[model samples]
Target chain A: GGIITQTPKFLIGQEGQKLTLKCQQNFNHDTMYWYRQDSGKGLRLIYYSITENDLQKGDLSEGYDASREKKSSFSLTVTSAQKNEMAVFLCASSKDWGANTLYFGAGTRLSVL
Target chain B: AQSVTQPDARVTVSEGASLQLRCKYSYSGTPYLFWYVQYPRQGLQLLLKYYSGDPVVQGVNGFEAEFIKSNSSFHLRKASVHWSDSAVYFCAVSPNYGNEKITFGAGTKLTIKP
Candidate 1:
């Protein structure tokens, strides 16, 4: 059994500040993903990595940058935090690309002032 | 692009009663559908998924979802409800042949009443 751990469960950033969220998974999966969850918008894919040093943009990757330096970890950076912005960032991993089981981290709640 | 629609924004059910949550998807080719549950202050967890084979798939915690290709719907159902079942449910689809990128619905918040 493995667990996906997300650091800084709660994040607070000033408007226009840059923030980074970290995720670590011991599952040793080949794919990792970052998703943003909003009040009425549900979960939107930010970015995903198929393997180490691989990256793919999703529907909502405009203001975000993702890194897959290591297979066990993935990180997301917010280019510029917007005022009154609030959302939950979730990290997930999969065994492979095809019809695989995805495991998620607790998530980082972001709030901007 | 593949998309999902969860028509119900919120649903409330009494304890020990039956439950059903609606979901609809749009895709050009063979579709892969998924249902996920998010408990309070937690990340979303897969309740069940449909790739091929069976149309009615059983998921965790006595939950089941039926996929009707004609209607383009995959609705989740449960025979009995518990207070712990209160959570937000999301329907998702993998439009591409593989699971590269998935689209999700707005989600339906389920509240169980005792």
Candidate 2:
């Protein structure tokens, strides 16, 4: 079975600092996505990549940027961390661009102070 | 825009008791619905999904969900829940056309007491 690996399970950043999270999936899925989960809120999509170098903006992509440098790796960047901000960033991949099943990574928790 | 709603924020049930979690969605056309479970500090795992054909779909851990198009609801249910069933459940939906970006509900935290 393939696994989705996310780096730096816990992340702490100072206010106004830039932070990055990385994800790698060995499933060789064609579509990758970045989602944010806030306390008491549903998971919201940030950005998605259909293939290498392809990017699509989701409803909550304002302060975030994503890159799919390779088919197996996708990364998310927070332009500027806000104070008192805490959330979990989740990475998911699917075999197809349609409504296929998704495999998720363990997630990276971010804390801004 | 497609949206999902999970009315209950938290539910407590005793072990071996029947379980039911409600989920509702707003969509214009045919909808693709899914139920996902997330254990404490763990990633979300797909429990069941409904696309077409059958309205009822069975999933892992003896979980199942029934999609009622007339009511725009897809509720998850289990015959007998276990203590390990304590987790957060999310309901999600994707539009039938265009992009496949999924919209999720706020989630319902299930606490199964032994």
Candidate 3:
């Protein structure tokens, strides 16, 4: 079985600072996604890429930018961190779009001071 | 637009007892439902999925979920509970068509009493 790896298990950022999170997958999947998890809000999709160099915004795409540099790697950038935006960011990959199963990474916990 | 709701935020059950977590969804077209579990310090794992045909879908670790289209509900159940079963359970839904985002519920935290 393949694995999805996310770098930087934890992140601390100051208000208005820019932070980036990276993800890599060995599954050779065609689709990758970034989701933000809040305490009571569950997981909200921020952005997704169907293939390399493709990006699509989701319900919660504001203040976030995503890049799919290659088939195996995807990255997310927080344009300007907010003090109230402490949350866990998850990276997931799927074989394809639609009703496919999503394989997820452990996630990066972010806190803004 | 599609949406999911998991009413109960937390539930505690005795060990060896039956378990059930409620989930409801709203979508205009056909809905593909899923149940995912998250253990402590771990990423989410799919427990089961309901595409079509049978309403009852079985998942790993003896977990099962029944899809009630009439009620727009999909509830996860287990015959017996164990301490290891304690975790956060999320309900998700996706449109039948491709290129759409999957929406997830708020999730329910399950606790098992030893």
Candidate 4:
């Protein structure tokens, strides 16, 4: 059994500020993903990595950057925070790639003032 | 591009009663469907998924979903409801080929009334 851990469960940033969120998974999965969750909006894929040092853009990839420096770690960076913006970012990992069940982290709630 | 739709934004059912949540999707090729549940203050968890073979897939905690290809719908159901079942449910769709990128619905919030 393994767990996906997301750092800084709650995040606060100022408008135009850059913020970064981190994720770590011990599952040793081959793929990692970053998703943004808004109230009633479900989850949107921001970016995903098939393996270390690889990245693929999703529908909502703009204004976000992701890094897969290590197979166990993935990080997301917000280019510029927007005022009154609030959302929860979730990190997930899968054994392989397509059609596999994903293991998720608790998520990091972000609030920009 | 593939998309998913969850018609019901909110659903409330009495405890021990049957439950159903509606979902619809759009895709040109073969679609892979999935149902995910998000408990309060937690990330989404897989409830069930349909790739091929069976149209009806069973999931954890007595949850199940049936895929109706003709209607382009994958609906989630439960024989009985419990208070702990209250959560937000999302329907997702993925393409069959290449690196699959999942598209999710707006989501349906379910509340169990005792």
- What is the lDDT of every predicted structure here? 0.92, 0.92, 0.94, 0.93
Residues A2-49 of candidate 2 have per-residue lDDT tens digits of: 999998899999999999999999998999999999878989899999
**TM-score of chain A considered alone, across all candidate predictions:** 0.97, 0.98, 0.97, 0.98
Candidate 4 residue spans exceeding 4 A from truth: none
Ranking by DockQ: 3, 4, 2, 1
TM-score list, all predictions? 0.97, 0.98, 0.98, 0.97
Of 2 and 3, the candidate ranking higher by DockQ: 3
lDDT of 3 by residue, A62-92 (tens): 9998899999999999999998668999999
Model 3, C-alpha of B31: deviation from truth (Å): 1.0
Interface DockQ of candidate 4? 0.70
Candidate 1, residue B60: Cα displacement in angstroms equals: 0.9
lDDT value, candidate 3, whole model: 0.94
Q: In model 2, which runs have C-alpha deviations exceeding 4 angstroms?
A: none
Model 1 regions lying over 4 Å from their true place: none
Summarize candidate 4's per-residue lDDT along B1-114 as a digit string, tens digits.
Answer: 898889899999999999999999999889889899999988889999999988999999999999999999999999999999999999999898747778889999999999
Worst lDDT 10-window in candidate 2 chain A: A95-104
Model 2 clash tally, residue pairs: 0
For each of the candidates, the C-alpha root-mean-square deviation to the true structure, in angstroms, is 1.2, 1.0, 0.9, 1.1
Clashing residue pairs in candidate 2 (N, C-alpha, C atoms within 3 angstroms): none
Best by lDDT: 3
Considering every candidate listed, which one attains the maximal DockQ?
3
Compose the digit string of candidate 2's lDDT tens values, residues B70-103. 9999999999999999999999999876366788
